[model samples]
Target: MSTGRARRALWRWLPPWALDAGLVALAVLDAWINLYDEGTPLIWSCVALGSAALFLRRRFPLTVFLLTLPMTLFMDVAVAPITALYTLAASTRNRPLLAGCVLLNAAASTLAWPLSDGFAGDQTWTLIQFVYTLATATAPVLFGQLVQARHDVALQLVEVEEAREHERALHAQTVLARERAQLAREMHDVVSHQVSLIAVQAGALQVAAKDPDAREAARTIRTLSVNTLDELRHMVTLLRASGGKETELTPQPTLADLQQLIANSGIETTLTGGLPPGISTTAQRTVYRTVQEALTNVRKHAPGARAEVRLWHDAQHFGVTVTNTAPTRPSVALPSARHGLIGLGERAELLDGTLTAEPTPQGGYRTELRAPTRPA
Candidate 1:
């Protein structure tokens, strides 16, 4: 991977406790080197205690610094308290109070040791030693503050990155939703053309039928087909308007609308059961569309066939079955986009369901669907 990604991956793999352990090790090493140079047992013990306090710096930073500060003044120990002060400056929010106390202590230590009367060295060498002590004492605090500033910048970058990721996800969802609406409009248009043809034919039949039952059936078929065309136009308009501002939407047809559907069909269609219990609006619409598509296909390709629609509970799931026998006459030839069954299958899968459309041995067609009784 690239450098930035590599660093992020390594940081993710490394735990915070491991870094704390490394800090403990550094503090112990610094204190041990001082003790080995010219240290007595009592001084060594104090150095060890101060080094141990460094382990607790992140948890109780100010407390650890207070405990180690006194050790530096009298014991001549160097690393333990300096590292503690570095941690305090790096991690804590309060800085000025710590800097003031640290400067005062450095002054006291310089006066007590390097510039004391016991020093028989030259005044120039004493001045250099005082400068060295002041510089060394101030270095850690400066470095720690710089580290803190970098850490704050990293946090802001991380927050900006997360916000961008969330925005991208929402944009993707919006695009997918618009695509679905467009596809639905296309499907409606494809089916609406055939339905309008049936309405025109049925209007002709309504004028010629002699028996009361045949006339009434012909009238119902034409009326329902015209109604279907109107609904399809409304859907297309809604889909087109979706590209601009939001528009008022109508609720989709539910399974309850199938009564009018079967009545209006010229074929003798029998609907067996009402909608199953606990069916959501999504599944209800799926059921309505499944029957609508199947019946429409029967009208186009198997005109005057006997069809049956049955809904029932099968174990923990609900089942919808639409079956039609062979047509009495030859099937008509319309524009065949031929994706209706594929779309139905996808809709079934969306509800954790399955759809099977196949021809029967009697040269007929059948479509069966199974959907979960509960929403997934």
Candidate 2:
């Protein structure tokens, strides 16, 4: 395997001009071996011109093939005419034209030079020679057509792979939009109703309470309720839109939300280090989600485990790491689609980052994300 690769590498190092020159040299050698004994000045000139015509075969395939025919008549030279015929066939898609060229090559090879000598020969012998020459001429044409077909099939395979990848991306986006719409319906039906009742009761208490502190507390509750309701409406609107062109999800979480997320995680977690300010919002969100998913998994899979969330930065990059100790108690099985880590990995890839999750030597699990500090 290594030897084959090394040979191919060496072949690639040769320039196009060098390969063409080598072919021309081979054609010249063929002419010399066939015509060196009894060639006239005209026949020698014909051979020379035919050999030189191979240089321009790639650019003018039909003209080059025609140039080689005179030498095929005067001298029995194989290299120049076969190479020209192969070039013409490979470069053209006109089957009728290629068929005509093959017949012309066969006729030239069978007939004797000076025209009259061919008719003077035995008719049966001439017919037999023509059949043999015709069969030989067809070999290069078939080979050239095979090469062309292989090239076209390769291009089509590349296009098919690209289309399949595009379809997969569209399917994933559709699934995500459907899930968001379902979540929006749940929040509107359940959470909105409960919050509305809280706001109404708080308003009534503010109006009826006698003590100032009690009334003030009721007023605060009503105010907070109103704000929460407003935020929920905005979120529901965004989700129901299904990411239309006119709207985008906004106010995404950042590093500032890390502490609150950990405190509410219901796990014994310690946060260490800090990220530098001025990082992109997308990067910040990726960091937040990595920690969130890691902690969630620890709570579900590693029962009674202690977790550590660490934020660190270097000269070129910054990210977060979440690690949890092994489970201290048996965990209850829960139904899960198991797509959370896959989603986080895809998100990190969009920001030119990487996510790695694996078990540690101490029987714990670790999830880490590393991203460029200034992504393009």
lDDT of model 1, residue 374:
82
Query: Could you tell me how far off, in angstroms, the CA of residue 50 lies in candidate 2 after the best superposition?
Result: 1.4
The number of the candidate with the highest TM-score is: 2
Candidate 1's residue-wise lDDT over 1-376, tens digit each?
5999999998889886776677667766766665566666765666566667777888877787766654464444566667777887798667786677577546544553323552665768757766776777688777888889888777556545544553454355355546856776675767877898899999989999998899899999999999988888767644532321223465567677878878886678888976566787668777877887788678767856899999877557887899999987544344444455656676687678899999999988999889778842
lDDT score, candidate 1: 0.71
In model 1, which range of ten residues has the least summed lDDT?
Answer: 239-248
Which whole-number lDDT from 0 to 100 does residue 88 have in model 1?
Answer: 78
RMSD of 1: 21.7
**TM-score of decoy 2:** 0.60
lDDT of 2 by residue, 1-376 (tens): 9999999898899986787788889988888888778889898889888888888999999999999999999877788888998899899889999999999999999998888999998999999988888888889999999988887777556545543554455456547756776799899999998999999999999999999999999999999999999999988865754321223645667788999999999899999999878687667777887898798788767868999999999988999999999988555444455566766776677568899999999988999999888842
By lDDT, the best candidate is 2
For every model shown, what is its TM-score relative to the native structure? 0.44, 0.60
